[model samples]
Target: MHVFLPDGKQLDLQQGATALDAARAIGPRLAQDALAATANGDLVDLMTPLPDGARITLITKKNPGEAAAVFRHSLGHVMSQAVGEFYRAKGHPADAVKRGVGPSIENGWYQDFDLPEPLREEDLPEIERIMREILSRNLDFSRREVSKAEALAQFGGDPYKAELIRELPDDEPITFYTQGDYTDLCRGPHFPRTGALPGAFKLMSTSGAYWRGNEKNPILQRIYGVAFATQKELDEYLHRLEEAKKRDHRKLGRELELFVIDPLVGKGLPMWLPNGTILREELTRFLREQQFARGYQGVVTPNIGNLELYKTSGHYQNYSDSNFSPITVDDEQYMLKPMNCPHHVRIYASKPRSYRDLPVRLAEFGTVYRYEQSGELNGLTRVRGFTQDDAHLFCRPDQLKAEFLNVLDLTVLVLRTFGMNDVRFRVGTRDPENTKYVGAEDNWNAAERQIIEAVEEVGLPYSIEPGDAAFYGPKLDFVVRDVLGREWQLGTIQVDYNLPERFDISYVGEDGADHRPIMIHRAPFGSLERFVGILIEHYGGDFPLWLAPRQVAIIPIADRHNEYAYALEAELRAAGLRTEVDDSSNRMNAKVRAAELSKIPVMLIVGDKEQEGRQVSVRERTPEGHKERKGVAFDDLKAELLERYRTRA
Candidate 1:
């Protein structure tokens, strides 16, 4: 048998040789250093038998992407062992702890256990100590394949593991890795030894999760831990998690009075408060103005449509699970609009278009609904009801590139406006093997190629992510790095060839024949709700002057100055600045503190001296701190405020 290396060099070996054997054949040094191997891009343990003619890439600590995953899985095993030890020391039997699945996740790993006693938050530190002790012993991990009957018998007392073994195919080889005093069932790639793992892991927290995430199943205590190749990386990640907590949008949403999710209204349905509403409307107005300037005509669409309408567009078939169940209207089914493209398609087909109207760009702030699981709901980010800054353009093949570029430019502008200027592009192409994706291979290829060409023409960096495409088409996604160094997938522009064809929409070409027009779907904000949620976290609820709901606070120093403050508020309101007059019986300091707490960008203090002089003692919030200008004329202050709002400074 022969296996190929990444450089195309071949190594001849026994037919049943493992990756570790291949590594030894290559060199003793590689065999010693290799933590895991990737057989044709699939990560496998060194002990896993390699198929003849397989292409293998040995992973070491330097290969953080693969190495971290291997060690992370090993860490989960170590943690599981430690949990058993921690329990046994408390007089519980060895098999007292029932196990569930433990898998490596992004930046970490987690294992679920059905414990006789619930694991508390305080138990994490003690578990950490045990985990370190296990790692210190440097236990060698050895794997063995077992027959189905034997595997089932070994885990028969544990229903979770036994059920998993029973579900495996007859031909599937069941394997378990033993390290020190513990063994568990797992599909390989894990570290060769506990010492191979870096001292850069920490047990983060514990939570109750149902076995297999199904509500009807028994609950298990899931412990989450994050691992990295180096201590520095681990430290940095922990710091980011800390910063993330500080910037959590849910916390800020409540503190800033932005939005609320009332149970009576329904889970995942957030009603925007006055301040949140202002923020949303401002964004909508900004995007609308930009779209209008770019020849995009605004249109309104219904919140729900007939089920057949979605069936025609393929959303009903492709995305029915994510979408809400259809509502019955007059004994006919009506679906809450899961997407705005289908409605826009009908609008395009309503009018017979010619080559002269080659590019028909229709824009909408259309509200759409999805059936999000209750547990998956997170503030405004994951919601059942949200409005998308959605638009669809139907254009002739010749104009497709220009139209796509125009939408891309608009998306970039939106990102830039929000200080998410550190942008990266991801081109999501269809996965050929995925039956869920709809459309011809040729159309998918063409759509993908056009998006790639446009991104290249703009001279930006991008990556091609397979299986990230919309079911109907390939898409260009914008991943923006916010102020905290966390990346969010924000805006998207998809070039769709399937939907137009499915809808049978056509335009008269110059040759006097009808031709199917290419369709482009774009949403710079993605959704107003989610974008604002990110914005709330990105800005830490201190929005820019233009976007701030309460741009100015007018605080009268004393009761006698209330008239002046009210007049100033009216003036600022008339000038398009959002202002609130702090006219309560509270003292001037209390009023100022209240204004600051509300995150108003500006505070105007009026008193006898200012009222008599027709001026304001301005206190403006800046990154540097509160800046004060005494007795600035009302005209000058108004001009400065207006300029900042105009320029979005």
Candidate 2:
């Protein structure tokens, strides 16, 4: 047999040679460091046999990004072994602890266990100690293929493991890895030995998770641990975690009184308070102005639509999972609108159009509903009911690229305005093997090509992602990294020929014959709720002058200054600033403290001297510290603030 390396060099080997054998044949250093290997892009353990003519790439510690999964899986097994050992030292039976499953996740790994006693947080340190001891032993890992019957017999005392083995597909391989006296049922691509695992790992936390995420199944204690190739990386990740804790939107949402997800209102439905509503309105107003300038007409749609409408758009057939169950009224099934495009499509079809009105751009701040599982719901980021800054453009084939570029421009402007400048693009195309996608093969290809060409024309960098497309057509998704270096999928622009065809929508061509129009669906602010949540964390609640919920807070030092403070508030409000007067009976210092805590952009202090001087004491918040200017003329203050608001500084 001959196997190829990444560089296309071939090496003759004996039949059924494993990756470890190939590595040894290539070089001794590679063989010694080979943690795992990928045969034709599939990661596999060293013991797995390499197929003839397969392309093999051995992974080592130097390739941390790719090798993290291998070592992380080994860590999970080690953690589970340590747990069993810890319990055994306490004189429990060897089979007293039952393991469910442990898998490598992004940045870490987690293991679920059915323990003899509830594992407490305090026990983590001891578990870590045992894990270190085990790692010190340099136990070599060995894997073996087993029959379903043999696997079940080995784990018979552990019902979780037994249940898992029974559920395995007949064609799927049943394999187990053993290190020292501990063996686990897992199909693994793990580090070669315990000593090969990275020392930069920590047990972060634990929680109760229902077995396999099913509430009806028995609950298991889940322990989470994060690992890195080096201690520096681990330290950096830990720092980011701390920073993320401080920027948690849920906590700030409560303290800032921005939005509320009340239990009485049901889960995943967040009600925007006055402050949060202001944020939404300002964002909507900004986007609307941009759209208007670009010839987009605002349109309104209903919250619920006839099921037949979605059925016509292929959403009912292909995207029914996220959709709420239909409501039956008078023998007609109506669904909470899962998408705004279907309604917008009807609007375009309601009346005749021509090449003269080729690009009919319709925009809406449409509220949509999805039946997200309760456990999947988070604050505003993952909500059932949310508003999309959605729009659809129906244009001729020639105008498709131009219109897409226009949308791309708007999305970039919106993101940059919010200080999310670290942006990347992903062109999501259909997965050939996925049957869930609905559309003619030619239509999907055309739509995907149009998006790619438009993105290329703009000279923006992007990557192609398969299986990330919408059911109806291909899309371009924007991923932006926030201040904390966390990435979010924000804006999206999708090109679709399928929906227009499904809806039977067309426009008169230059020759006066009916021709199908291409649809460009875009939502720059994916959703108001999710965008606002990210914005909160990005800015740490210190919004800019234009977007701040309360831009100016006027503090009156004495009772006599109340009138002056009210007058200042009036003038600020008249100048299009969000202003408030703090005349509540609190002390002047307390008022200043309150303003600072609220993250207000500016605080104006008024007193007898300021009133007599026809000026105000200005204190403005900045990244460095508060900048204070005493006795600034009212006109000067107003002019300076208005300029900032106008530029959205």
Winning model by TM-score: 2
Clashes of 1: 0
Give the per-residue lDDT of model 1 (tens digit) for 60-95.
767755567788999999999999999999999999
lDDT of 2 by residue, 418-533 (tens): 88899999999999999988879998988888888888988999999999999888999999999988999999999988889888899988898999999999999999999999
Give one clash count per candidate, in the order shown: 0, 0
Clashing pairs in 1: none
Using all chains and alpha carbons, the TM-scores for the candidates as numbered come to: 0.91, 0.94
- Residue 534 Cα positional deviation in candidate 1, in Å, after optimal superposition: 1.2
Taken over the whole model, the C-alpha lDDT of each candidate is 0.91, 0.92
How well does candidate 1 score on lDDT at residue 141?
Answer: 91
Ten-residue stretch with the least lDDT total in model 1: 60-69
* Residue-level lDDT for 507 in candidate 1: 91
